[model samples]
Target: MELSQEEILARLAAISQGTAVEAMKITITEAFKDRVVATMPIEDQHRQIVGYLHGGVSVLLAETVASVASVLNIDIDRQLAFGLEINANHVRPKKDGVVRAIATPLHLGRTTHVWDIKIVDEQERLICVSRCTVAVVEKPAS
Candidate 1:
């Protein structure tokens, strides 16, 4: 099943309610199996002591985009996606600006998915590079 961009945003917004992603003001700009893109603003709340974008925050944004992309590729009614593992390298820091994270699949398997996420500042400078692995699990009976 395929969803329109607006539909994807609505779904992502629902998932983000009251979560850290919502606090970071993440906006889903593009959503598809081939690629997913999101943006987050660098604010005081997201900064570390040195006043730069927190490395953890970059990893959070990375996982969010990659995990959501994994979810988008699965059967929503029967399966759910969860982060199995993730790693990030913060190449640069942002003091104040919006950072965009683009996630593209490296492997989409029956039970697992791997994504490569590249985060860039508003000026298109690389901020972080991340790889995320997601496990696709059968939804528990509820």
Candidate 2:
């Protein structure tokens, strides 16, 4: 059976417990079969030595959204998705407040999925653009 939107979001949240997603305070705001959105506040921990948002954090957020979206597309009972590769371009610097990541599928094949992710600040200015490839594999029996 297909899960409801709320149920999918709850499952995503549950899987994120005690992970970097939780530590970074990333919240999955909107989730759909084809798209996913998340937001993270820029706190001290998210900043680099010069106090700008860390580029790695942007990449992390990008991969997180894309991977979660991939999981939603596959059969969780039989398939597992893992990020295979990712690339990002940082366009703007952010110091504080929240940034949102929106992810959409570029390619969804039986073995792999590619996602385009955009990170924007509160003003809707582009902060980072990323593409992530997720590998889908059969789940090993427990």
Candidate 3:
């Protein structure tokens, strides 16, 4: 079931309180699916010595979205998803413009799920692409 925004916030609130763990925050500014568009505009700090966006950040955005999508089907306590593998390909680099990534569901299996992420920029240039695989784990008894 899709969680209400309030419920999502409340659940994430617990993660933020330190009793739980959540790696990424689904901010209100983020969009999803077709409406999903994100831009991490390049800054001097983000740039490499050659003046290109750090390649690591590009992969981070892709995996972050994939992990977020994987959590949609997960339970609070019993079962959680964790990354098993991630493969990223850097097609090109941009030093001045914004960088964005979009994740699409590649497969959702009983025990595994995969997502194909495509990263682009404000000018609609391909930056990086990645595939993330997550494994579903059944937690031990409390």
Best model number under TM-score: 2
lDDT by residue (77-141, candidate 1, tens digit) is 99999999999998986899799999999999999999999999878889999999999999999
| Residue 5 shift from truth in candidate 1, angstroms | 1.7
Residues 5-44, model 3: lDDT tens digits = 5675565446545321233222322434322334466767
lDDT of 2 by residue, 8-116 (tens): 7898899899999999999999999698999999999999999999999999999999999998899988999999999999999999999999999999999999999
Model 3 stretches astray by more than 4 angstroms: 5-37
Which residue pairs clash in candidate 2? none
Error of 2 at 140 (Å): 1.9
Q: Considering summed lDDT, which 10 consecutive residues are worst modelled in model 2?
A: 1-10
Residue-pair clashes, model 3: 0
- Best to worst by TM-score, what's the order? 2, 1, 3
Decreasing lDDT order of the candidates: 2, 1, 3
Model 3 lDDT, residue 142, Cα: 78
| Best candidate (score: lDDT) | 2
Instruction: Report clashes for each candidate as comma-separated counts.
Output: 0, 0, 0
